[model samples]
Target: MSAEHLDDIGARLAAARARVAAAEHDAHRAPGSARLLLATKTVPLDGVRSALLADAAARAGDPAAPAPVLVGENRVQELVAKAPHLADLAPEVHLIGPLQSNKVNQALGVAGCVETVDSVALAERLATRCAASGRVLDVLVQVNVSGEETKHGAHPDAAVRTALDVAALDGLRLRGFMTVGARSSDPARVRAGYRLLREIRDEVRDSGEPGAEGAIELSMGMSGDLELAVAEGATIVRVGSAVFGARPL
Candidate 1:
């Protein structure tokens, strides 16, 4: 790794540690709640390898260990490329990017959680793959709360229906709802979007569906808005650059 890359990772790690500390001190929060899933999309395997090694070293002597490292990827190719070894290192491997029906089999090969189930066709494909594999795949419905055309998630109002449909699939477990907030300098919009997704999750829960417990996860956050996400009941935060450094060109 370049010296500059090391510096970038050091700074990001410090920031993540700081965020954890703040989250711990936030007494208004639940006793045991919310989790971080560092988004590793577009990041090389080496970067995650380095960060996990460092984290393990730092916690060697501590009695209360830090949370287990969780990794997320945004694309099928990347997940396929880096998952074999990482499967043992990371407790969870989430597919936090857009997924298509054609890629379900590949996704099933590596993913522990598919966090961006946005369509009926893709959901059915995932279930079929899971059934064939004799595995019950966990999944999250991606909600486009911001209504951005460029975004890949479904609209917030449609998230529940989509999630329930996926839950009904033979071998799929509707694990939760996830979303990527609109980018902004103020951060309020992003924060609001996180809250909105959380509220949507609760609504789905209150529906008394069979998959409610399995689908309680609300994954909404990245490096920039993770704090806001945690504050607003984000069970999974997919932080990329903030935990890992800038991607190599």
Candidate 2:
């Protein structure tokens, strides 16, 4: 990255940290805590390195400050390319992208948790891999909460069924549901989208078919409107630009 790009990266990282801190303070604390995932899809390797370095520096100064929580990658290949650079950075690495059946093994190699377990085929693959590795994995049912025709999530009507199948597998723990809120800036639509995800999470818990005990976590919201999601019951917020600034094209 050019020096100018690096400077921009630093400023964006600082702003993101500030916003996350503010969000943490605004919401009523829930249970042990809410998870804040740093969406790092478009951030180049240099920027990621810079951000990680900054996180360490911040922690050295104030232990209470978060160290960019969990980092998520939308693509397995991108994550694989960047994984070595991030090996010592974050403890929890999430694959928030759509999972192709053929790529499940690659995702398993890098992602600590695959957040978009949308299909039974993919879930079964993950179950097999984790089983062979003698490890249990965490996953969320990605629901098409926005009802967008172009979105890659499972249809809202089918999400719970898929979640049931995924959870019943021996290797996967059905953590909860995740959704991308409607993109419109209109607050009402975003809230409604988040509410829909929450509603499904509640229904699945009530049905008791997912085979998980304890409260489910709703992983919704991004940098744009995470506060509203928290208001509606988001247990994990996936934020990117609000933390890292505009994505690098």
Q: What is the lDDT of residue 131 in candidate 2?
A: 98
Question: What would the per-residue lDDT of candidate 2 be over residues 109-218, giving only the tens digit for each residue?
Answer: 88887888888888898999899999888898888888888777889889878888887999888888888888797999989988888888888888866475432888
lDDT per residue (tens digit) for residues 1-249 in model 1: 665675577567657866855764573665336666777777767777777666666668877766666778888999899987666665578888888777877888888888888888888888877888799988888889888788888887788788777777888888789888887776788888888888888877778877766678888877777777788887776767777766667
lDDT of each: 0.77, 0.78
TM-score of each: 0.90, 0.87
Give lDDT for model 1: 0.77
Model 1 misplaced regions, further than 4 Å? 7-11, 30-32, 61-63, 87-90
Best by TM-score: 1
